[model samples]
Target: MEQLFSKALSVSVRCRDSEERKSTIRVTIDLQLSPSAVHKRNLHVRLTDDKDPYFLFTLSISEEDFQSLKAQQGLLIDFGSFPQKFIELLELCHSEQEAESPRFLLQLCSQGPTPEGPSSLSVVETNAFKHLNHLSLRLSPGSDREVKDYLASCLARLKEEREALELRLKRTEEDLSRQLSCTQQTLCEKSKELEKLRSEWTSQTSSLSSRYSDELQSEREKALELQRRLQEQADQLRQELESAHRSSSQQLRSRVGELEVSCRELTERKYKNESAIRDLRMKLVAAEEEGQRSKQQVLSLRRDNSLLDSQVHEKERALSQLQMRAAVLEQEIKDKELLMSRTKDVLEATQQQKVSLEENAVGKDAQIKKLEATVKSLSEELLKANNIIQKLQTEVKSLVGKIKVKNTVTVSQEKVLQETTEKLQSAEKELHSSRQQLGTKEQQMCALKEQLESTVQKLNESREVLKTNENVISWLNKQLNERQMTRATAPEPAAAAAAATSGAKSPLYPLGRATLPPVGGALSSPADLRPTTQLDVAALDSKYFERVDSIPIYGLTSHLPKEIPRPAKASLPSAYFSA
Candidate 1:
């Protein structure tokens, strides 16, 4: 197992310059050592910085002291106790020529003991030198008298500097007071100026308001006059339109009567034409029927002629078969020929009758086309009359619409004028209210300034009280210390107990009795103690604890009681110590 301990030391190195002047520099030394090396009767020490510029020399420990350090790790070994060993270590670092010659000779002096304690050396281990131990030597300040004198001089200098700062602070405070007075005067003057400006603004606003009201009155008068004029004009236009409407209506009635008479005459003529057309259509239908009958008759006559020819052919064949009947067949054939000629005449008569009926139908169709043309002309005339009536009605409606638009425009203009006047009045009211608000805000600012001045006075008084309290607290701490010393040095237990009982009744022990635990008992927490009012100094001797309950000491009521468990060391605030 490897065990190592590192010791930190402050090293003082003294060296001579080229002019033989001695100078010293203090540097921290870190030493690390392994216990194994010391157990083998060999001491190896290493430094944190092997190439330290200040500590160029070498150091070592004796075998006995090395063994002792191994056994007792906390032991401090002083190099000054063995000057010969230190000198030998120094000699090993310098050459013979360097040591004998004046230019390179090294002078090493061991430091004497200091008032604080004896100067000691520690061992440090380094990885660079595992088989050897290096040492750094340092000396503390020599005596306590010299240190006391130095501290006294420093305190005197600090006092002088503090007096100078106080003087500077006083001058600065005086200057600030004068500036504050000047600012206060300027603020008063500005307030007066603001009041004057406010009055002038109010006067100007009043004048502007009156002028605007007068202008509004004139505008209202003009609007009323215009309204009256528009009404008169509308009345005149209405009368004129009524007269024109009456005349146009009479003329329209006469024209309508004339158109009605013409329409009646045209309708009567239309009825007569319609009757003639119907009669012609009926005759044409009858003739078409007669033509159909004549067609059938012609077809019948042709069939009869074909039958007579066939009979004549049959009679001639019989005559050839019998010569004695030849005369009878010839007479029959002459009869059939007469019958065929009579049928051909009947067919010709029927074809002529069909042609005559077709001509009559065509004439009737021509008459119907002429009647439709006349009816179309009459309808066109009626449409023209209807368009004229519609135009007159549209013109009358346009005139009425123009009158209504004018009336609406005038009414809207009157309403706009009233709304503008109301807006102006509201603007005036807003300006008045804003001025009032500004005055109120200025008053509030003045009140705030007065409150700030009062608060500053209160703060100054509190600071003075705090200084007095600090002085009293220091005095109480000194008293508490002296009492503790007396109690600790008391000889006999019976006497010490008597002294403790007496001290508990004393005014200085008023808080100690409440805070301290009973003999041989554990201390109770502060929360069990009840808070009380500030102690009255005059009542300390007579009425220390009027009530039986424990009262918490001032300033020791919080975590202070927990932190300061010993009653002898715990110091209460001035309120409890004041007498």
Candidate 2:
């Protein structure tokens, strides 16, 4: 495993140039180890490939430490050799200084006797070089004393630097708090504007829909009244026709009864005349001839009665045919009424579509305005962040200049002067690190700007989509209206009703997802209106997708950029101690 670890070991260190006099020189050291070693140490290593090297660690140290460490002798001088003793010492320092940053220290020790105390400053002792006696040398008593004194002076300077850093932190905190309050106030104002717009939009939509419904209801009532009148007229005509037929049949029955009585009386008289003629023997032949004439007359009377009955039957058949015609006319009128009702339904549907489109258009305008406002707000925020970053950079530069001036002035003070110069260097390094952090913040701001631009692009694409949808809906509505008008004018009631029903079933307003607000609710500044769109979503409905409201409009809410967290107050002092 050790052999494999050695083979896999690949580390590189990069140091920033000292010519720039940048306080802290970033030294990046990358360590790659073998799989066996990684598993044994339980290291979180990143590997390029299974057969390739795995990166185990990357650490940053100051340029001065890098130089001093490189100038050392023994096995530590070899870059490829793993410094187990040095890693142990760093771990020990970290454990001891868990509550505070570990101070910078350079001390030498040999593999002679193990250090006996749990002191914070313990030098690393190598145990792998037993064959080299010179490499096992220890620190002399006099050098140790000098090293302790130097450490004491350095510690005193660090305390002073810490005090200065605390004052700066308190001032920065006050500034940040004030800025945060201002941002919060602005956000609240935007939210209020959005709420007002939403309320107005909802009210308008409701009013329009209610008006259309009322119109539809009134039209339906008129159609019903017309149908009732037509039905009444048809019923009156049928009643009159029935009464006329009943009176005519009654008159015919009376005439038939009168005719039957007269015929019976005539038959009796003929019978008596026949009996008298028989009584007279002399006129036998004459009586016989009279009887034959009477029989012929009776047959002619029977034929006339049959003709009257046939005439009565024909009159009744004509009346029945008239009644059938009246019933058919009534059915036709009823079908026309049904068709008229269906046409009204179609009209209502079309009107509803128009209202929806208007609402959508208004909503889109509002959303666009809202987005613009949000963009403006974001731009303002970016400007603020940039300003802050600039201020920080300038402060760092000024601090650097001050440290330089101090170092030059302290040069003549002898022992105290040298100690002050070292302290100034440490302070400069801290300032440099802070500047680097500020640079990082500036980069974050740039990324945020890029995100805003991307969101704007997406919003534009969405607007285009809404426009196309609107056009398509309008065209469809036009076609439906035209078709309905034609059907309403058609004479065939059944055909008209069928056509109207078909039209009514066709969708009036096509459903679409939109993130924009309605246009009429415009506030003073178009740019400031953007935040309202986001705020309106939460206010409108918690579950819009599952509600009837979703039928009309849906919008993807664009989230705002995350704000950077405030920096800690002790960071600068901790940075100094680390240096």
User: Considering every candidate listed, which one attains the maximal TM-score?
Assistant: 1
TM-score of every candidate: 0.18, 0.16
Alpha carbon lDDT of each predicted model: 0.53, 0.51
Q: Ten residues in a row with the worst lDDT in model 2?
A: 18-27
| Weakest 10 consecutive residues of candidate 1 by summed lDDT | 560-569
After superposition of all CA atoms, the RMSD between model 1 and the true structure is 73.6
State how far residue 89 of model 1 sits from its true place (Å): 99
What does candidate 2's lDDT look like per residue over 1-579, in tens digits? 121211121211112321211111111223434455212221111111123112111222233333344555434443334344444444443344333333322222222232221111123332444322222212122234544554565578789999999999999999999999999999999999999999999999999998899899999999999999999999999999999999999999999999999999999999999888777865877777898899899899999999999999999999999999999999999999999999999999999999999989998998999999978856775676566557656765666666664443333445554555565566567656766777798899898778777656655544554454466446446544544454456535765555555546554531211222343232233223221111133222121112111111123333321221121223222110121
For model 1, residues 20-47, the per-residue Cα lDDT tens digits are: 2323322222233435543223223322
Error of 2 at 300 (Å): 99
